[model samples]
Target: MKIGVLALQGAFYEHRKMIEQLGAECIEIRQLSDLTSNRFDGLMLPGGESTVQGKLLAELGITEPLRNLINAGTPVLATCAGLILLAEEIEGGEKPYLGTLPVAVKRNAFGRQLGSFEYTGSVGDLKDFKMTFIRAPIITAGHSDEVQTTAVFEDKIVAVKYRNQIGLAFHPELDQDTRIHEEFLELCKSFSLNK
Candidate 1:
């Protein structure tokens, strides 16, 4: 399967490497042509500055097409700031970017860079995986019918799934464990087969 990693900024390279290690073709999407010219089975929106990424997507003419693909049920794995982008609502009245996932997220809910930390937690049925949070967001609430909380930390929602899309408040790409990536690939495979 082929996966596109939004390479405008942040941890995109890590996501690309993880996807490639999982035996899939990884494409780095940096410009408008990358999105328009390539066909991908899935897309990875890596952890980055949500505002900057949002602005770049629009400036590069990628926002609408990418949003359309996501809304069309293309599988996606979004982490950290990517989670903020996918949220339908953001805390403190910030405008959502993609707004594909039916969840409300609060940016930097875990505090700033100084508040960054790591913990071993379970993601859905996946257990004891290390999760790293760096200025992460938290899913404060979700649309019960459309979203399911898959993981939690300290009573805070850290991961959620809506259809083929998964939004993680922690960075799974920063760890050695590949289970999360594997799960995403599985989603991509299922999506491909169904398509």
Candidate 2:
């Protein structure tokens, strides 16, 4: 199966490598043309600065198409800033988001870039994953009761998965372990067969 990673900014290349490691063809999506022409079973939006990523995505005219695809039940794995873009509302950001998930996010919730951290945790479907967080945005709230909090930090949710969508406030792609990617591959496989 083919998986597309948003390569506009941030650790997109890292995500591409991880996805490729999962035995799936990887597509680096930088332009709207890529989104239109590519046939992907799943997509990953890597961690980055949400405000900048949002504006950059707008400039590329991919925000809407991505939102549409996810709404149509396309398998999506979003990390950090990518998670922020998927939220329905951001606590304090003027930039528009893709609004694919029913959650509220607080940008830089983990504090500044210097306040970044590396923690060992069980990321639900993928256990014992060492997650790296750099200026991460935490999911402050989820409107739907169906939203399942997958991982937590000090009792605060850091990762969640609902249906075909998964969001993480940490960088799973940055880790050497391919379990996260493999789990996403399973999500892709299920989504593809069911769709």
Candidate 3:
């Protein structure tokens, strides 16, 4: 399976490495041509400056195309700042991008860089899931019933599955555990066959 990773900016390399380790072709999507030329089974949005990524996406003419793909039921794994892009709203009134996932996110709710932490908690069905947070955003609220809350940190929603899109407030790709990526790749496999 081939996965297209948004490489405009962020921890995209980390995501790419994880995808490769899982036996998938990882394509770095830096421009509109990258998206148009690729036949990827899934999309990965890694943690980074959400505002900058959003600006570059629009400037590079990739916002609409990427959104369309996600809206068309393409499997996507969005983490940290990536989660901010997909949310329907930004909790503090910052702009929203993509807006494919029906949840509101509070950017850097866990604090700045010095506030980052690693925790072992339940993520979806993985009870002992370990996740890393780096200036992560928290899903404050869900705007649709389709948004199924999967994992919570400190009683706040950290992960959710909305249809084919999976949003996470923590960096699963940053860890050695491949469970989350494996699950997403399985979704991609199913989607590839069905599509």
Model 2 over residues 1-195: C-alpha lDDT tens digits?
988898888899988887776689999889999999987789998887777889988998998898888988889999998998899888865544898789998888878989899999898856678989999889999989889999998887999998889999999888798887888898899888877
- lDDT tens digits, residues 18-95, model 3? 989989999999999999998889999999999999999999999999999999888999999899999989977877
Tell me how far the alpha carbon of residue 186 in candidate 3 is from the true structure, in angstroms, after superposition. Answer: 0.3
Better of 2 and 3 by lDDT: 3
The collision pairs in model 1 are: none
What is the overall TM-score of model 2 with all chains considered together? 0.96
Q: Residue 47: error of model 1 in Å?
A: 0.5
What tens-digit string does per-residue lDDT give for candidate 1 at 30-53? 998898898789999999899999
lDDT of 1: 0.91
Please give the distance, in angstroms, between residue 167's alpha carbon in candidate 3 and its true position after superposition: 0.4
Q: Rank by TM-score, descending? A: 3, 1, 2
* TM values, all candidates: 0.98, 0.96, 0.98
